[model samples]
Target: MQTELTLNERHLYLHRYPTRQNETLQAWDAGDEYLINHVEQLGLPPAQNIVIINDSFGALSCYLSKHHNVTMVSDSFIAHQGAKANLSRNQCVAITHLNTLNELPSDTDLVLLKIPKSNRHLSWILDKIRNTLPANCRVVSVNKVREIHTSTLKLFEKHLGTTTTSLAWKKHRLVFSQLDASPQPISPFVEWSVDGENYSLKNLPNVYSGESLDLGARFLLPYLPKDERFKRIIDLGCGNGVLSVKLGQLNPNAEIIGVDESYMAVESATLNVKAALGPEFQFEAKVNNCLDDFAPQSADLIVCNPPFHQQLAVTDHIAWQMFCDAKQVLRAKGKLLVIGNRHLGYDNKLARLFGKAQLRQIAVNKKFVILQATK
Candidate 1:
């Protein structure tokens, strides 16, 4: 179903994609509407330089585009694509310039943001805004009413400035804030120790499978190919480049590449790769959507720990996309290795994509299984 959203005195019909296998889930939520409503009430200045962060769909961007000059920031390639598609559908001129977390534009008069579900990523964005914007820049952060509280305010206070939540509207809340009179230097990325490893891991807020290693990833570690004879290796959906570090260790000479949709994840992975492998490690990690830009028949081996969700809804489209993209990028006789829950039926996906899929290992009593597919 499509939603006709009226915001900033303009009405737009935004197309929200349904969650995979769950047709009932809509692409957007009340939080998005609340942000738009709050902006409309502000009677925001014309041609004002406004920035919006974490807009899940085009709802917020499409509305703002009609009146104010806007800049949109998000980490998901799919979300960005959805926003553009919706803009075209509505016959709306793109008002806000869209950018990823890795490339934030400079100072602006106002910032309208939807609180991302990942607290880690939110904190990073807060810190980034604090560091880049002037001391008096205004920021409005909107979220569901149930998500606001003292701790939430404290998080904003810690980096940007004193923050207060507005009264609830339709079970949603907006945070009013300004850059603190004296903002500290951007805090370092949050750091955590990887168990059984000497090197500490660091992360930006939105990176996937953060801090502690993912359960499925942990199970897939030992099964990694023990030899380093492969020519080209990719850590598909590489979060913080952990698997790349391991893959590098296993095949010291093979060229490794890690890719993810989150800018923070790519930054963290780049740092971790250098720290873990010393200056000798040869690899590239960048912000991308499942190798969307990779050339076909290029990679000789691919490793993946595909994500099961995008934002709050669970889905396997990302996994399916990863598998499909891997096939396009893998050379003839190349292989793709993945670890996932047994119930996800990834074995079938692999079989269909590669024509040959085999279970390499399984952890008894655990849902994780490692599978290999060859082209």
Candidate 2:
């Protein structure tokens, strides 16, 4: 997979963000190729303010940065890292980076966007574009032809103004839109209250388990390991930091850290944590992949509601990595608790990572299993 990808007469190498696993996933997709090809074929000139949304890696940015001033904006922290890694590997100049939902630059004219899996996410991006872009600005969005639908076109028309599509090329289609300076529109972020948790969780369009408290996490909450009081804790895949907020409130002496791969998740979790712990508490939320940078045996307890997939593919590599990293960061006799779907078969994986692991049947619900492993 490490080979030259020629786009717009330029060559570059790209990889998906690091998985720390053996998944053979390509970094870029046909949509990426289609968008670049469209601009080139149309004789579009490069400009100083080129904004790219969700360029999974640096493929688009690296190739375009040669002439255009590029700014990379995404929600995934891993994508940002991958873009930077590939940029350095290609010896390309560093590009500006911004997390999703951030303020769009005042000089933005040409926008390159990739359609996300979530309609909510796409809606938010479109909302941001509508609020920021100048009249007559051009936005080029692409996706696999299979993903394009009437609703997709409606989003473009509703948010950005007039829109049209190019004929399918290589099973991908490019969307062309011009800013219409339409009336300001609003898209609301979703909010839900956990039934018994006394917490209202806010979900950004792209955060995991956005519709509600994930069933596994909800099931595991009542059974949270309370065998002993812990002073240092980590919430591994803390979706909205609800677990940490609750944990912080319950354990007065504990200092907590919540980490997620998505910057939007971390931001949502941080807000929840603040509302729960106030300003004087010792807790922080950060965007990180597993426990990559944590020192060995630094946590007294680790809690996780691990993710089973990355991007479009469903896989358990992320869960496996999280379990292994939890063991590395847990103090001697420190505990790691995770909630997962019953069919995932995480017990054996945890046993392989830790010397021993136990499965707890904490509920009558047959859909989920809570696994606890110790270092």
- Index of the highest-TM-score prediction: 2
252-279 per-residue lDDT for model 2 (tens digits): 6788999998987988888777776787
Per-model TM-score on C-alpha atoms: 0.86, 0.94
Model 1, 211-289: lDDT tens digits are: 5787776677777785555888999888887788888888988889999877667788999989889877889987676
Candidate 2, TM-score vs. the true structure? 0.94
Among the numbered candidates, top lDDT falls to 2
CA lDDT for candidate 1: 0.77
Clashing pairs in 2: none
| Runs with alpha carbons beyond 4 Å of true place in candidate 1 | 3-9, 16-25, 88-107, 134-136, 184-186, 278-280, 355-365
List lDDT for all candidates, in order.
0.77, 0.82
Q: What residue pairs clash in candidate 1, if any at all?
A: 70-96, 120-205, 121-205, 121-206, 228-251
